[model samples]
Target: MLRPDDRGVLYGEGVFETVWIRDGVARLRDAHLARMARSAALLEITLPDPAPLVDEAEARWRADGEGALRLVCTAGPAGGEPVLYATVTPVPEAVIAQRADGVRVVTAEAGVSRERPGWSLTTAKTLSYAANLAARRSAGDRDMLWVSTEGYALESPTAGLVWLSDGVLHGVAGDGVLPSVTVAHLLSEAGGVHGEATVADLDRSDGIWLVSALRGLAEVIELDGRGRARSPWTGRLSRIVSRRPG
Candidate 1:
């Protein structure tokens, strides 16, 4: 948790990512670290060497069981210094199972600042996660958290852009929000490209997914607070990830 005195806590300011590491190997560490670095640069904070952090995470995965990895960087409690860290943690079995089965989702307008200037760090995945966390709290077990602003579906609380349209891959604006490294990786793996879409477009697509590194990928089995009937594509995506070279 973010400490009270932490700048990222007092004022939302930082960037972080949950990486997908399996069998002690991170699937897309480079992409994630590069994104983190870009975010830190945008925020004007000095970044610690991520090589050491990745080494540590890899060590832990070897010592522990296979699972998810969460890397968080804070601006420090004083709010004006470089403080970065990362951790390797297990993806909840239940969460993974849910991903395998698929999840329900609700889209709500994001409270992003006009310029996103609430001392808030929209680009940085900082500790000031109150609003997103609250949205998650209000979400049901099957509910995949979503944030939209001005009628545009931005992203999920902890996941990346979810776009669903026949064979055309889609994602939100790259510069509008933080770039989703995991989403990018999946798009590459699927031999697909990122396209754009509306919530309605998603609803009328061939598949819907909440792509993240830790969970690899998740399909939205339910939508608009309704339990959507299961589809075959969900399992197919899972199999694809499973067969992917680690």
Candidate 2:
């Protein structure tokens, strides 16, 4: 439990990672911890050794079976150690269904100034998610694809974009977007580009997929009410990421 003055509660000072677990194994645990450590350093929050939490997450998954395991570390009350916790919850039906059925999305202005380059919190998964939540709420039932004022596709609130253009998978340039671990892994396996594209340009692609730890690879079947053709690569890409390392 958090004290009344916890930094995470008062100022949203913290970083978090959502991990996908299957058969008691937390997928990409090392990559998740690396990103969390990078985020903690950027925020100047003292991150404790993650070994205990990692063990706890694995134990919890063994007892509870497959689900989403969220690891949150935050700056707590002044002069106290950072607060860390692992919460495992059932994966939402929509998220599971989207893995196979795909998702429909609408575009929105990301609000943040993507034109001005900087190493700010945009790359970190911080608790100050008010803007991300607002974007999702604005979308209602559909997912929101954030685009810059210059018409460049940014990313969704929680996932990264990967579209197939002329047989090449492409994601938004790493400059302003969060460097997605999932997308990076997918690109390493299947090959892709870190570049910019407008919504119109993305729509014309042979296939569009949203990559994330939990979502795996969900193709964008419809964008802004326009239907896209089903892709043959979705299943192959899914299997590539879903492989459980021995």
Clashes of 1: 5
lDDT of 2: 0.85
1-246 per-residue lDDT for model 1 (tens digits): 556787666566666767777767776778778888877777666777777878777877764456677777777766356567777667789777766677778877665522465444566665566777788888867554444454556778777765546665666655456677767766666666766666777777777788766666788877786566566666666666555365
Error of 2 at 5 (Å): 0.2
Per-candidate TM-scores read 0.83, 0.94
Model 1 misplaced regions, further than 4 Å: 1-6, 77-81, 111-120, 144-149, 242-246
Give the clashing residue pairs of candidate 2, or none.
none
Measured by TM-score, the strongest candidate is 2
Per-residue accuracy of model 2 over 1-246 as CA lDDT, tens digit each: 888899999999998999888888888888988999988988889898876887787886664456798889989888888998878887787788889999889998877667655557788889999988988888998898998888888899989998888889887776567779888888877877777789989978888888899888898888999998899999898998788744
What stretches of model 2 exceed 4 Å from their correct place?
Answer: 116-119
User: How many angstroms is residue 153 displaced in model 1 relative to the true structure, after the best TM-score fit?
Assistant: 1.9
